[model samples]
Target: MSYRRLHYHLVWATYRRRPTITRDVERSIHRTLRNKARELKVFVYAIGNVEDHIHLAISILSTIAVAECIRHLKGASSYIVNREHAGIDFAWQTGYGAFTSGDRDKPMVVTYVRNQKRHHGAGTTLSDLERTPDDENEEREE
Candidate 1:
């Protein structure tokens, strides 16, 4: 039998980088992301978020496109958040970052995703994992 394994560390910000992901909605967003991933036959290893952005460690089947998987996760999570939480305008920013991780480094990536808040707080974040497309533009303009 043929074998395949793919994993990615995905990061994206909220629309305009607004702090829409509050404490009350954090759980809902994480749950929605995981549920949506499962529905798409993707495996979500870990998820973490702050007020403005999120990080996910996931494994996708060879048949699934990474962009499509991210689209579904973002769309479904925002939809559920808006529906469940009244008066919240939740939307993701235009672009995202997807970094591939080897099977051996999967555990480290998962740990990083799962401890996003702590990493951010302690200033221990890995820049590459934390970068979004917005950062790319800033770098070019610099």
Candidate 2:
């Protein structure tokens, strides 16, 4: 196959640690993301946001560059939030973390997104979700 589907579990925090990602804001973000994803011809398997950060489980088509797609999502959504919610100022962090997932993991990833509220409430940090022992070992090796 000349092309491969890439599923990305992407996460990013708010700019300057504003912590404005409340439930209502999250709903808006989800809707906005869905619309944009549709326009970009990307499939959004799931999306969720906590008070400080957001997560997206998406399968992007091979034609799209991961970095460029993220930039558009982040930039547009940030502007939408700032415009729609006049009282609140929102901006995304300059960088994000993305992990590739296998096709078989899509269902489980969707379930995880649905439970993000409970997970975050139970003190499961982003690192807690995606960390591997190898990462620590690599850091130590470096």
Candidate 3:
């Protein structure tokens, strides 16, 4: 027998950072993520989103790589969302932010992921979590 716990805070955005995550599609999107996570034997602690991006706090089995989880989740969610909602051109941007969180810090990460909308609305978002690769490039170009 073996024991291991791996928690992660995952974040990603829509294709080209488009604001396509609307109220109506939010349900479908979350459902898709949950379903895919279950199929991958991953546990989703929390999920939150704004118009363009999403956050997921999850614990993945040692057997699965974080990138593989993201690839499947994003691909299935995109497929389901676009299939369910006709004319919605929803796609996830390539690349993601995967930050490891210790078991002791898992609760905080879950809370942060769960409150993404409020955090963004109240201007209390943690910059480190909100930033993406393109953001860095954009900053350098400034």
* Candidate maximizing lDDT: 3
Q: What TM-score does candidate 1 get on C-alpha atoms?
A: 0.91
Model 1 misplacement above 4 A: 135-142
Q: For model 3, what is the alpha-carbon lDDT of residue 22?
A: 94
Q: lDDT score of model 2?
A: 0.74
In candidate 3, what residue range of length 10 has the lowest lDDT sum? 133-142
What C-alpha lDDT do the candidate models reach, one value each? 0.84, 0.74, 0.86
Instruction: List, residue by residue over 43-110, the lDDT tens digit for candidate 2.
Output: 99888767877788999888789888887888778777878777887777676778888989877777
What C-alpha lDDT, on a 0 to 100 scale, does residue 96 get in candidate 3? 81
Over the stretch 36-76, how does candidate 3's per-residue lDDT look in tens digits? 99999999999999998899999999888888889899888
Order of the predicted models by TM-score, top scorer first: 3, 1, 2
Winner of 2 and 3 under lDDT = 3
Give a tens-digit lDDT track for model 1, residues 41-66.
89989999888889999999877798
